[model samples]
Target: MSSIRLIVSDLDGTLLSEDNRLNDSVIDAVRRFRASGGLFTIATGRFGPSARPIVDRLDIDIPYILCNGCVIADRDKIWEMAQLTLEEIAPFLREADQAGVTVLLFGEDGIRTLRSTPETAYFEQREGLPCVPLNPGDEAWTERPVQKVVLIGDMSQIRPLWDRCRSGYAREYAAVQSEDHFFEIIPARQSKGEALKKLMAHLGVAPSEVMSIGNQLNDLEMIEEAGIGVAVANSHDELIRHASYVCRNGYGEGVVEAMERFAAIGAGSKGGNTYVD
Candidate 1:
């Protein structure tokens, strides 16, 4: 049997194809892996409502990471959550809004925006969730706990905010670039890696028994935390640098390649460090 007891992967730009759909090979491989007594799940920046369909499609029963690790839950219940206060986020919101950047707030209630923009509409359509308008002065919205804050804009507009957040709030919050136009903020010390650690403990699995695959900077920590870290062919340069193995294939193909190389079903021994073509 493979030493890898669990496999966690990122969604966009990693497991999902460019068209934002799962490839058949990926589905088949995951089903086979699970059937062989291996556990599988995803760690993504998407929320429960948006990520639920993917989980259902894969038929994963384990708790998965969400909101870039601010929340962990399964279809039936939330196992863990980390939140940020309005005070912690208010300044960044003001700066982003003043700069004409679109901000999306995530909470238990749902996604909300201070003001609607083309980006807001796109986000709504893509996530299949409405971005309800919440005035800056609204006290009711503040009553809800926020799991994450996302700022969407061109790189020119986002870079400054990302830099400022990193310099100013590094001690209190984690600022990561989920995409070229997407800057995300979650509580400091909370990340896909931290959440994965929690899940490992819950399942009584050691770090040496885990393998993680991802393509973005937000996935860095989880990749580093796993026993085998894989970077897809389309991964960010920095993430590739940290990965133990870099795949020649991208998207679901890369996922399948990694599984075949590292977690092959019924393999008597663990796989080696060779890259897949």
Candidate 2:
């Protein structure tokens, strides 16, 4: 394939470690690669604010494709936006309430949930985040349009919810399983692959000029669209099988390894360890 100029990545599982923090090696490799003329950015299911910490750690100033491409942000400014309509989400929300499943709403104001139950509290604590209870006329929900609808609950309840929503509104929304007990609903037209393509086109780069690394089903589409698709060592079976190359390790180390392997040509060496940081 042709040379790559951009590297898009998934955040939680692919780039960040189990502790939810960025790895030093990944940051260094990205800095070295960018310094050598490549651009890097995040493609995640998280809201912009939620992704900012990792972005800051990487020190990348490029526009971020967030909320599974529901929105793209550049230096805190919105570059593109897509969101599920209130009508589209209302039915799902009602269903969750009836099923006693926990629902979390993410947007510009951070994370807001319908009920701050133990389950929801566990999520908030796991992420070291705060949970806002949905109060009628709660300014947060009313003022901020949702970028993603996250739900945490048992398989029996969540499965039926996904089936019900997917059966009825699949045309308007994309129902993705972020975890065994977690499901996220996004706008159907929005995806990291589509957002990456748009961003590359805007920058005058072709699809064959990009490389993408990820480790989840969501990252599969982005990988399929890029010239070189790198899956981390811990990537799911399908992702590993579909990827053009598989990294030697997982998380930050895997990302660093991929960059070192692919960027060597641009730097004029065979997988050189030239990362300065």
Candidate 3:
């Protein structure tokens, strides 16, 4: 018998398909997992405005670890949240702007941008969320305290910006690239690992009884923290190396493979579909 009782995954490149969409296989697996007396959660850098659509599609009652674990929402209850201090956010945004980076601020209410551009519009459309555009001249928009700031740009261009900030502001903010095209900034004290630990405690489960899967740099913390860290074929090299097992398949199939290989999943688990890779 396996000791695993919980499974957490990252979205975007990790769980979302190449086209940035969630497939039926992933949905079925989640439903089945929940039905089989297991708990499933999404741990991602995405804030509520961007992560909610994916959550709605799951159609299950489960907590979501959002904003790179700075925020944890258990349905109507908010168990944990750590917002970046105004002092920290202001200087960071200033540095990013000076570095020619596009900054998107996320709050409990919605997402805001330092300046509205076609790039931000595209992101809002892609994620199916509304973004409040910030006017460069509106000092208030630029100065508002925030929960998190998402910097959107090509990695080649953003890397330099990140390097500059990192060199001067180590551990001031948890800087992570949730995707190749974007970087997320959150409070340094928070992480998917800490959020999972809290979730396990709240649910009365042990850390050794959790299994986690992810495929990106931001996923590294939770993956390393979990007792059984399973990386999909598409996972980053470092994550693959750190995981206890590497799934042969990628995407949803990879998730299926891990569950079956580890004997933590079974047929007739939940919904109308059983995961078989």
Clashing pairs in 3: none
For candidate 3, write residues 103-174 as lDDT tens digits.
788888888776676778888777777777776666676445677878877778777766765676534777
Order the candidates by TM-score, highest first — what do you get? 1, 3, 2
Span of 10 residues, lowest total lDDT, candidate 3: 268-277
Q: lDDT of all predictions, in order shown?
A: 0.85, 0.76, 0.76
User: What does candidate 2 score in Cα RMSD to the true structure?
Assistant: 4.4
- Write model 1 residue lDDT over 202-238, tens digit each, in one string: 9889999999999999999999999999999999999
Question: Clashes per prediction?
Answer: 0, 0, 0
What lDDT tens digits, residue by residue, belong to model 2 across residues 1-277? 2277888888877887765666666666777778778888889888876677777778878887888878888876999888665654576686786678888888676788877788877876656678788885444454456788888888677877677666666366776665557778887777888888888887787878888988877788899999999999888888899999998888767777787787662222223122211
Q: After superposition, how far is residue 68 of candidate 3 from its true place, in Å?
A: 0.4
* lDDT winner, 2 or 3: 2
